[model samples]
Target: MDLERLYREDHTFFKVIVGDFNAKIGPRRTAEERHFGTHGVEWNEQGERLSKFIMTTHTIHGNSQFQKPSHLRWTWESPGGQFHLPDRRRCCSEVLHGIGPSSPPR
Candidate 1:
């Protein structure tokens, strides 16, 4: 995708990408502490892909950077009211470091 292309072309630019990636990266894993936090849902197939991309591109998962209440974590609720999904945000480490501790907006 465009992100991959951008990363391939240049590795120095400050970048921040936010959107509904439809990928569930879940909570932080053993080796993923640098990229994820402790307040995410379960991981899925797409989550693996996105996680790989984040690692490969040296990007931080913005949504997973802070601790949020379970209620505020998900961006979409199922029509049946039985499920919730997240839309993620990612940014270069440079940008991530500039941000201070805070919670996600309601």
Candidate 2:
């Protein structure tokens, strides 16, 4: 993806990409601690791909950076109330300063 290429070629500026990736990203794993947090739902095939992209590009997963109430964590819910989809945000760690559950808005 262009974003991946940008991450690989540039290091002069902080990068932050936020959107609904439609990937679960599941919970945090030992190897992905830097990029993921422990408040995710479940991992799936798409989540695996997204995880690989984040690792290879050396980006942080913003959705997992802070703890949130269950209601606030998920971005989408099924009409029947059977499923919830979490959004994903990929950013460089440098861009994450002062951004957290308690951090002031920039």
Candidate 3:
């Protein structure tokens, strides 16, 4: 489950395995879910850590250019033990791509 470490060890093989990755793969490209992974996006420490691992692995070890934030969150419907619920953005997976110090390199 330690995706970061996995990437760190094997990123050099990405080209051989999957070819040059474009780094545009992800969710949340809609108007409503646009801020899904933005700075203000809500997440616990574990979530943040996973996000950092994924992004860093892609950028540094994999030599890839990231577009959006590679983070995620569970919606209200996915909470309280109920699998489905009305009036909820169930799969709001859009993330914000930034260019600040926090952003991944180009």
Best by TM-score: 1
What local distance difference test score does each model get?
Answer: 0.77, 0.76, 0.43
Off by over 4 Å in 1: 10-12, 77-106
Angstrom error of the Cα, residue 93, model 2: value is: 36
Residue 65's lDDT within candidate 3 is 30
Please give, for residues 9-103, the per-residue lDDT of candidate 2 as tens digits.
Answer: 87777887786667888788786457888778888887898898888877788877777887776556668877745554643445555679898
Measured against the true structure, the TM-scores of the candidates, in listed sequence, are 0.62, 0.59, 0.28
Candidate 3 — which residues are off by over 4 angstroms?
Answer: 12-40, 54-76, 82-106
In the range 50-104, model 1's lDDT, one tens digit per residue, is 9888889878988877787767766565788776455445433453343445845
In model 2, how large is the Cα lDDT of residue 13?
Answer: 75
Q: Global CA lDDT of candidate 3, please?
A: 0.43
Backbone clashes in model 2, listed as residue pairs: none
Better of 2 and 3 by lDDT: 2
Worst 10 residues of 3 by lDDT: 16-25
Q: Better model by lDDT, 1 or 3?
A: 1
